[model samples]
Target: MAVDQLAPPPAVPGIPLLGNALPMMGDVQGFLVDTYRRMGPVFQVRALNQSFVIMAGESANRFLIEHGEAVFTSAESFGGLDQQFNMRVHVLRGRPHRHLRKQLAAGVSRDLLAARWDDVMAVTDRTLRSWEGDPALPVVDRFQRLAADQLSIAFTGASSAARFEQLRSAFELVLDATITGKWPRAVLRWPAHRRARAEILAFAREALEQRAQHPTGGPADLLDRALAATDENGQPYPPEVRAGMALQGYFAGINTVAYLYSFMLYALLRHPEVLDRVRAEVDAGGPLTFERLRDMPALHGLVLETLRVYPPAPGSARTVTKAFDFEGFRIEQGRRVIVAASVPHLLPEHFPEPERFDIDRDFAAARKASVYAPFSVGGHTCLGAGMTEVLAVATMATLVRRLTVELPRPERPLRITATPGPNPGKRFKVAVSSRQEQADYST
Candidate 1:
């Protein structure tokens, strides 16, 4: 039977050739969520002369991401990646992807990251100083800048303090170019875009080469580790591959950590009471010490809750490698499937009163009823989850330890950006004051 015949009909009709592309192009994330409600979890959309099957809901997401066909590959999604990231190695599939992943694991082991805790603390302290006495500072921007600096120190040992603006602008430009639906070939060939690409690549290559020559032992950052890594064949990558890894490492850290920080800050800003309670808990729990940071059950609960609500990578799209049976449906080879992350976060069975941002909600008690995956699941799950937690604890603990952010106008709702963010829109004008003054601003 034909794949189309076997599968359910598309959730919505398209404009013949255009399919559902134009509406989606306007707002990608919103489009996906809204369509899913109308069409159900699995639906079809066509764009750029290709048919894409968007799948969501917990069961569908698990089935698609966990099950793969020989022909299904990440290659398609990553093809344009080279233009933006200068990455030559394909994360698509097969030996090459596994080799690179394993080598990276060896390079940025948990122990290595743990050793750099002092550096992270130093950067966090410096960032806190930036907000020391500001009467109306935006904590969101501060968090973004802080995370950037921390990532700089953790990844390249570069002091991102001075270069945060430049690094952020360059990254934003790259993300702005890539995250939207596919760009035309003409745009890729444009001299301006080409030049931007070349400049970023050149900068990354220079940094990696410099790091390779002077290795930082002990708590070496990711760059130094990548430079020191070797494949099973005992072969180290050339300058370009090492450079690409370094660039990828930085890219991965910048927005992701920033977004997580933003989400945490947003939660605090939105729920001043929760923020106050958290501050007290942190204080009472102990001096916001690194070792004790994770023990703060409230903060941990908040982190998990924020992640559930605002997953950085909400859904992932991949091409099918082989024909597979999914939920009694025949998913043919080479077709595309999307696994939505947001659906499970909102699923009634998984989260009671899903919209409410209650931190103390028992996630453990709702295990089978919940299939919430913030970092995703399976072998491709995010490698930086552990490091992300450490960084989050350091950041949040630092803020709570030193000062409380006083939102100038706590009544307004903050604006959000169109895409997943390390930096989001709608700044909150806040003041950093001693804990005693927090009561004055609370009401």
Candidate 2:
């Protein structure tokens, strides 16, 4: 078979069964990019005794995600997500999945999100003001705190949201356990691992039980509504299912949101001019309100650009359930195909001057043409993307309006920490004030 006709197996030429596993396992993105450079966009790699074809570039990714939905299954892509959380329904494929997705979408409509802006901004303002005195706090942790708090408010009303501190500790343990477990040979039964897992389960159990028994009315947060949802047959979810949904809320909401906020802060620090430009746009609108925020294009560009440059979850994969042929090589059933997001995100075809960070570059036109998809694509596209974006924009816009921020020095070029994230060690110190020095710049 000609290599050009079918997808070539990700190029793994040497080493037997566990070919390229050791090197690739530790740094998946780095290994994928390196392999692509050494071979081509598509190549074969063996990890854990399995030979899987990895795809790169925008067209390849689109073929796998958008066009080849039947061949590649998200259930396989996010395999252990169920093991980590109880909300198996949300991640499940087919009828139940579609129904739940529709319900979630209905609940989180644009109008609902707009109505929640007051609460979102209130949480953001309070959180930012709390960090006023600290001129040198690590932005990652700070952003994590802010995001977690906002999520707490967004999901569980203001009065109930005060428990975010407790939730944060639980979430941290969950993230630590999950990330560590994903690494090879890390025993989940280890004492530290067991303890972390227990913390997560305990937190989920309490939150679910509390929300289930005592329901809050008026703009249902994720928790209250999830607890109220019925299965496909119009029956209440089983106890396990209910517990699963609650756990999913915590897992889905915290770490990813933290990553988004952290990346946004990293972008602001790295690109001072962009930050200043965004601040100018916000300042020209006068007082920070939900109405003005939705109109700020520069801030919108900042959010969009940040995600394009440093996506929180850099790669999303799907496994082949059926045998298929691509670029000439036979892709056997059950093999995984990883979409290399970090590389594709930088593809010059999709994003011109892919290496450069420029917000002025017109993405709206390209996005409409299916050139950009940071949230991943197809049925498995992120459900919380809309909420996360609104939160990021709201928080960032408020900070710019109410605060004067200055990076002591330009942030170092971000380095990958956990495959798809910026390591927090490279902290950028920024002096922040409650009031502006001068309103010289205007949008």
lDDT of candidate 1 over 1-443, digit per residue (tens): 55545764354677877777676554354566677778677777787566777777766655644564344565565455654665545443656666777766655455665666677777676667667778877655666677777766666777555656655655555554444344444565667666666776777777777776766555666677667766546787776677677776655566777778777877887888778777777666544445666578778877878887777666665777776655445666777766665567766667888878988887775444336666655445667777787778667766776776766777866555544342345465677765553332110
Per-residue lDDT tens digits for candidate 2, residues 292-375, read 667878777877887777665556566777776654567777777766655655667668787687877777765665446667
Name model 1 segments beyond 4 Å from true.
Answer: 1-4, 13-37, 45-51, 69-71, 88-90, 132-141, 161-163, 182-193, 232-234, 285-287, 322-336, 364-370, 420-423, 426-443
TM-score of each: 0.83, 0.82
Local error of candidate 2 at residue 17 (angstroms): 13
Q: List the lowest-lDDT window of 10 residues for candidate 1.
A: 434-443
The runs of at least 3 residues in candidate 2 whose Cα sits more than 4 Å from the true structure, single-residue gaps closed, are 1-38, 45-52, 66-68, 74-77, 89-91, 107-110, 158-186, 191-199, 406-412, 419-443
Q: After superposition, how far is residue 138 of candidate 1 from its true place, in Å?
A: 4.9
